[model samples]
Target chain A: MARDRRGGSPPPTAVSTDLTRRARIRDAGLRLFSERGTEGATVRDIARAASVSPGLVRHHFGSKEGLRAACDAFVLERGTEIKERALFQGELDQPELLLMHRYLARSMVEGSGAAASMFDRLVQATQLWLERHAPSETPDPRGRAALLIAMELGALVMREVLSRALGSDTLSPEGSLRVARAKLELYSQPLLSADAAARARAAMDALGERLDAAAAGEGRPATGAGDPGG
Target chain B: MARDRRGGSPPPTAVSTDLTRRARIRDAGLRLFSERGTEGATVRDIARAASVSPGLVRHHFGSKEGLRAACDAFVLERGTEIKERALFQGELDQPELLLMHRYLARSMVEGSGAAASMFDRLVQATQLWLERHAPSETPDPRGRAALLIAMELGALVMREVLSRALGSDTLSPEGSLRVARAKLELYSQPLLSADAAARARAAMDALGERLDAAAAGEGRPATGAGDPGG
Candidate 1:
């Protein structure tokens, strides 16, 4: 059943025939969980959405919590597969991929232990990707990867605001492309001049040192010394 | 009373002397709202946290909704002031600034009319900042700014996941600096090589054209043509 679901990137209309009943339930669970969050979606809701019985849902996944876990696992696996294809094969226009991204974003926002684990896995993957493919040198590769993941997922989490700003729904194809293009533009070119970045880095380092000194009970008060206008 | 709160970036210990009861309640509201979201924090809770009576809370802000509006306005104004200072004056180490960022992130995640308005204001501010300070030439300056803001605020929203990835609390000064350093590193350099970026852009453009063509009922089905493995 899992293999059937994972085997093909079937069209939405073909989903009914391509997936097993269990896969259908899981897909419904993912959609509801993504849209309404875990607490908002009950077992009956998932069963109804899947056009199955509540008893069948329990028999397959045990409970709502179990169903969520199954959804989490499925999403993580599918997301990894889609991301790998996009990165290595340059296959960027997968429709199911976007749904998976949305699911992951919603899952992370409705945080749980599973979400944290998923985030960590993504960060590790990003860090590895950066180490292998990135042209620029980074002192803290982990932090950079984590930041990148947060920013990307953040866009999904705040899609409504982005859509409002762009006067279109970011989850839609056009808006997604617009966002992607903007991201490409931002990443392909340096936003800050080299000189300014150097100065900012130096200032941050100095501030970090000051913060360290303050933590050590140095001459400056920890919380009050740099009170901008006070 | 409002002036007392806005006048100085007093130390935490001096909060009592520096802010009036109303200001204290507002500040407390901001903290709780930021931490707990709009629904999680209550009027009685805000009053207790501020060490004031519920009657005084009502006298000052009328209701929780009123207090929230007051918080939204105060945060927006203060956020703008801090951002302007940070951009123009290069003062990036203000402690209160982080709290404001936290509050806005929570507000945005909670999603309300006020949150949408605040997001619009932020996008506008970012667009102006990009025009003035960003060296890169962007075809869609609004989209770029909106993306940048989403990414930055997304960091705050997903701070817990980020903290776990970094093994430190991102809200803490040290962790914040680490994240800042990483951001500077990222912003200062192009992640994609010029050749790769050009290729990616070309591919995206081709895909966009195809999507437009498909949307217009040309050569392809809208939903299923590019199903990687199907």
Candidate 2:
């Protein structure tokens, strides 16, 4: 848990040899799962990556699903820890944090109960962050937070395409820095003028009202038309 | 291609019965492919969805891969047409446009050559739009555009989670309007104060220089570490 000069966590290699076998297996699972996804990375692949037998992997986590759950729990816990350190302690340059981000991105794209839970946790955390630091006049704060998180996760999910678009791999340290700088630039200034935003907002409001009226005339529930939840 | 009173394209249902069998198969492919990933949807499922014989589907599109390629081409062409109409003619209220967006989102997440091509096209289009509408002092306009496109597509890719978070399906007309409004609000106002953004930019600059110096000292290519492309 030693902090480097920049207050970031020590590199993974620094403490790699000291980890227990179970911890090693979990770390391997995180890496493989992030890189190859849940289906692409088999138990045999994880076992080989960890320099352990397939049976030992089962002994440690029961099955691939169990291994994934362990990985998910580890990612959630470690990701929160890293985020707090980065936010509160100014440990923002940690490279290992990307692994957690990648794992979560894959999980989110794959979609599962675990992924939904992770996404909800992130939305809640982002909502809290917005309220505390970047408070806004957004009426639907939860929706705003959810949208913001989706945008951030979207970059990770579309990392390959983004990397190509940027003429560099976004996950690399230099490329990561470049992307971060670009985001800082983008968020620092409003993309639309106040007049434009107000006009767009008004237009959306008009559309909503018109749709509601049309639905009422048709004798149908306005919001229930395309409820994917049903 | 008759326009509605609002300047949007006619709804899909209006032309559904007029479509040829080939067109029907292609449309079904687009819908199924968007809902299910490339692997998740099969020729049989697509044929069933289209109410066509599986043999007919094969006769028209050759195979599932061929069907997907045809769908990709159609999405790109139709998406561009819809986008142009939306931008130039104010046809922004078209609900069917969501189908194109969903298909592209799924393709982007699945990551094939087609997906990469589609993403690059989007990045290019976005970069053009930025240059025309919201020019900034960003040194890397391509990177900025790529990030913007990723954020937008990210919303579509994570639509289900976003819908759950917002308590409504984002793909629906009402939910789409809400999401659009939220985006307008977000883009209209700067998320970070100028002072904070400047501070972050300066910090990132310092980090970059430090990393470069470290790389130089180590006699390694500065940007070569962790290059996923390599």
Candidate 3:
């Protein structure tokens, strides 16, 4: 009965074929969704894009909602792939960083639900990376991770904004990448150093302690404790 | 003839009155425009918001376009004020920084023309600041300035994004301030150090020189001069 459901294919033993077909459907869905949006792109359109029958789309994913979720996962995996390549495979050369920034800039402004979710996932990935890689004694890894992600993505768009402000087209593809590399080199010199990262982590911990103490004192009579003389 | 246009008011020798009236109109325009957008808000709506006559709105700004431009200028000036206060008036306390960040996060996502232009002006101000404060020997002040501004504003929104990613309400008034203080403490410890700043400036100059050399070789064919072995 199951094999018959798959249009009389072999007894469902071709796992590789099934996996490849699913990937094809997802890739096609991403393209169509990016072009026309989820609501605008129909199941038939996605099937045509993937060069498969509508039954294949239905068989692989129950509905458009499922297909869209798969597309989101694919985009997130791509972001993770970029991060891994940059982290483990030696230094990320200028071109490689450029590719990552371009993708990010595009996604940041895509205004689609998937693009928004993809960005969220990237931030979460940064948090996870910090937890695993940060010094065991590091405090406020979440806060530190947020700062790193902010600077990384910041280096991307700031290139364009600065180019516009400075009355130059340094924001053109090649030029922006050049500017981005220069900025990254400047920021990363300190941020990437083990000593600096540790120092920053410690600083964050101290600040958090101060904040917590201050919060606790809200009910205390401030006249004495807050006074410098006291 | 200009004096005659005034509705029986003094000859407008009082510069203070002119300034006050202009500010009132601009403030009203900003509020209305932010709430309803430029096209959605009318001159009458702005005048009503300001408790002035429609004629006064026209008198201060020739049309809706003029009013909107003034609003942009106002927003830019506000941003500059925050930066100046934070830089000069000792360390920016958490609340002060939080206030500025809230305004920025709101402006960045406003999707209004005023917001976009205001952001542009803020970038320009950052460029000017770097050119003045960075080491005299530093090259590519514009690029460096852009990097600084990107980090600054990126710090602002990344707080919100981080809160969202962590599923914490770090964006609530007090919570956001706490989160912001932690991140700021982490970034500022190194950024405020004279030694780090000087090192960063020197590195920027070195990268600029490297980039210039690479660009100069773009049109040259592969030859003995470019070959590492040669």
Residue-pair clashes per candidate: 0, 0, 0
State in Å the error of residue B92, model 1: 3.7
CA RMSD per model (angstroms): 7.0, 8.8, 11.2
Cα lDDT tens digits for candidate 2, B1-230: 23332222443454436666678788888888888778778889988887768998888788888888988887777788886776676555566666887888878777766778878888888888778667797898888888888888888888877787788887676787677777776687777777777777777787788778877786433321111100
**DockQ, ranked from best to worst:** 1, 2, 3
Model 3, stretches more than 4 Å misplaced? A1-74, A82-120, A127-137, A166-174, A188-230, B1-67, B82-87, B90-138, B170-174, B181-230
Q: Residue-wise lDDT of candidate 3 within B90-138, one digit each (tens)?
A: 4445454444444444344333455556566655666565444333333
**Per-model TM values vs. the true structure:** 0.80, 0.82, 0.53
Give the B-chain TM-score of model 3: 0.46
Show the colliding residue pairs in model 2: none
Using TM-score as the measure, name the better of candidate 2 and candidate 3.
Answer: 2
- What TM-scores does chain A show, candidate by candidate in order? 0.80, 0.82, 0.45
Least accurate 10 contiguous residues by lDDT in model 2 chain B? B221-230
**Candidate 1 DockQ, CA atoms:** 0.34
Which has the higher DockQ value, candidate number 2 or candidate number 3?
A: 2
Q: Which candidate is the best by DockQ?
A: 1
User: lDDT winner among the candidates?
Assistant: 1
> For model 1, what is the alpha-carbon lDDT of residue A179?
82
